[model samples]
Target: MNRKIYISLAILCVLVLSLQAACFARTPDKLPNVKILATGGTIAGSGATNTTTVGYTAAVTPVDALINNVPELKKIANVSGEQISQIASENMTNEVWLKLAKQVNTLLSQDDVDGIVITHGTDTLEETAYFLNLVVKSEKPVVVVGSMRPPTAMSADGMLNLYRATILAGSREAAGKGVLVMLNDTIHAGRDVTKTITDRVDTFRAPEIGPLGFFTGDKPVFYRAPLRKHTVFTEFDISQLTDLPRVDIVYHYANNTGDVIKALTQAGVKGIVHAGTGNGSIGKVEYPAVEAAQEKGVVIVRSARVGNGIVARNGEANDDKYNFVAGDNLNPQKARILLMLALTKTSNPEDIQRMFWEY
Candidate 1:
């Protein structure tokens, strides 16, 4: 009687195992399609030795190698890759930004491509992410991911970061969340996320607003959504443009003479983002140069060098008096991006200031 009971239990276990196998086999068809647009960064970097995280050659690895290195990605999404560029994020240029944005729009417009994961270097990842956030023209999930450590380093984080990014891009929960920057398992809004630490793995953070979500399981778990305008809601369109208007950032310091501002204006930049002191204050020494540039019809946006805080219009500096636009919560680099796009539509300070607040 005992032997017969054991036989029955064994048969039941086999039936359960078979059912699980069948379910697993059918999961691929149900998985979301995710496309990886690889622009080279530290995530694609390689080092001379395992401990050599710094001074490593970046953009050494191709998109296919990155995908194939992580086998787990196959279980969560139907993944494919395309090489966008093979340069470090610091070398990221307006030409590449235009190309990337156009390609992203083209891909997300297709029905087959459900979402996109962009592999970038941490140096300018935030900038690229913010650029796409405004111009992607799709509600589909777009995740920008990178690693501080090279793939060959000890406890290398690239493959895992890429995997989590793939999961995020393919997730239904990640849709309509704006472009996201994922690193160290944290998901941040592209417009708000910035690299806070230079060499650490947990470098990216949204200082004032915090992260949009995190990767908790097979899918990304959300805690909040971005309140700022982004993606499909933005008015900046770049479809016909071959190049963006030249915008430059000028850093402010004690006794600064604003020589750089004058040079930028003479060079014919359409706009300038001043990385001013607290609350976007212009040094008394440099004020005239700023005014002179503004007189030339070069848009001057006052952005603070401080990491977190709003550069309120008419606060420390008299924006109304100077005809200067405040940078809102955007950092200097991001402010430059917005100013570039803003120049495309209107040069009016009021119209551009409204964009500073809205976008």
Candidate 2:
């Protein structure tokens, strides 16, 4: 071989290696990146092999495994999974919520991050989703998803939930819609989502409002939009998710005494929800303690404990006399969610009531 040809071949080999390195570059400016923040939900959960009927530890399951199972996702977007925590939904606290929020806030601050997907347990997911819906300040896609079954189930559902959620997070249709809950292939606005099923994969229903859309293949199609002023997209900030608000709920019983409400307030609660027995009607004796709480600045929301039905208002004679906001159809927990989010804006009862109505 000619000596000059040998030098040319060496230079060609160096250029090829350089191109390979550049092609595999991991920079956000160079490659498309979407942040996948994992908070333990059934989607990332693992239950004992013997217990295969859906109950499992949230976040104990891994997103990477789900991604590997759904290889087709590579065609949609680059995915990187970061485990925020692994805990059951009932065990979630304001601290964890704030941590998740911080992760989302940080990702949104990064110009390279195009969107975010959070894997959360379905139990408290609606509330958490609602929190982010009102607080995160980006128009970029922010999606939350969970599973009805654990990874060890006979046919676990986490893999599909994560895939559809990722697709929605990377889709333009989900942007400016605030946080979304993508589950069972349905795209739900965090604000109106409710887990309507006790035990089924097809849970999480929006009876009042239909789903935002459905995730088809590697794409998301929007059919409706949420009509509420939620977090992040709201004109306010709920970084207050960090402060664990002391909110309590009292369920009404036949001849219900007011002790529970008084005791909870005496126990140092900052807010309370009256799970009125019927139509948000409080027992006659229960009014005084609640009234005292209101006077003491303990925010109150009138909710129903019947499991279903709206808490309608009639001149506030029963509840408004005590200065409470009708929780509409929102149960105790959901009402607490609204109160928490509302408190971030103002402590005024009128403002809080208006927030509940509009949101």
Candidate 1, position 211, lDDT? 92
CA deviation > 4 Å runs, candidate 1: 1-26
Name the 10 consecutive residues with the lowest summed lDDT in model 1.
23-32
Tell me the tens digit of each residue's lDDT in model 1 across 46-120.
999999989999998999999999999998899999999999889999999999999999999999999999999
In candidate 2, how many Å is residue 338 off? 1.9
Per-candidate TM-scores read 0.92, 0.84
lDDT digits (tens) for residues 1-359 of candidate 2: 69999999999999999999998664444434677887776766667784566545556656567567777667667888787887778788888877888778878888778889888888888888877777787888898888888777777887777777776887667888878888888888887788888779888987756788886765688887777766454655645445756777888889888888888878877788888777877777877888887777888888888767678875334555556788877778778877776766677777777776777
The TM-score, computed over Cα atoms with residue i paired to residue i, of candidate 1 is 0.92
lDDT agreement with native, every candidate: 0.92, 0.77
**Per-prediction RMSD in angstroms?**
6.0, 8.6
Q: How much is the lDDT of residue 146 in candidate 2?
A: 83
What is the RMSD of candidate 1? 6.0
